[model samples]
Target: MKTEAEIKVAIETYGDMIRRICFLHLKQYADVEDIFQNVFFKYATKREAFDSAEHEKAWLIRVTINACHDFLGSWFKKKAVLTEDFSQFQIDPHSDQGHLLDIVMTLSPKYRDIIYLYYYEGYKIVEIAALLKKNENTIHTRLRRAKQELKEKLGGDYFD
Candidate 1:
């Protein structure tokens, strides 16, 4: 069993990161909570040692992503509209940052995941490809395409 201090540290260090990831994939608070707990539960139960903090964070991220996929596959997941109201998920919906997230959440999961990992998590294309088990070229292509789509969705002044 992991020590309490370790668990607490992990939660403190990565809780918001995990929450944001879960929120990106799931809209309903209940679903997000379930997946978020599942990620930590798996973390608590796993007995693997990490080479570094980065490795540990990467493991948690990968597990959290898998947990989101599992939740989506579960029978309990309702097939509701993908773009439900995310006001509660935002820190400040009126702000431009939140507006950007609102736009990002409108994207399909493929684009959303890539964008989050690339931009929010500060992972490079090659690193994202490795983490996601996709070809590096595929990650590059998706990022390029996703940027174009975001630009179109946000109009010409998006990055300005």
Candidate 2:
């Protein structure tokens, strides 16, 4: 297991990114918090050393994605009907950024992940493909389709 200091450093470095990924996938503040803590806990217990900071970040992202998927797939999640409080998610719907986020949230998870990794995270197509474990061509196609869908929904030159 990693030392406390190491775990603290990791949390400090990637906390926001992990939380965003959780929120993107789960769309519940409670789930986001759960997965955020779980990710760090896994990181702390992980025995292998990463090759570099980038590798560490990539590992964390993968873990967060997998954890979210697992959570979503759980029977408990399927059965639970807890009230969701969006206020904790903190997107101001009146703002342009919030409007874009709302639109993004309406997208299918596949497209949403591609868009978030490509545009919001500033990852290149190749990088996104690697991160998502998808073919480069698939990533390219999804990006194109996602942009088109967003454009249609926004009815503006938002992507450009």
Residue 68 lDDT, candidate 2, scale 0-100:
91
Poorest 10 consecutive residues of model 1 by lDDT? 78-87
Give one digit per residue, the lDDT tens place, for model 1 in 59-93: 98899888898888877675655566655655677
The digit string of per-residue lDDT tens for model 2 on 95-145 reads: 998899889988888898889888777889999899989999999999999
- The TM-scores of all predictions, comma-separated, are 0.89, 0.95
Measured by lDDT, the strongest candidate is 2
Alpha-carbon RMSD of each model? 2.8, 1.2
TM-score, structure 2 vs. true: 0.95
Clashing pairs in 2: none
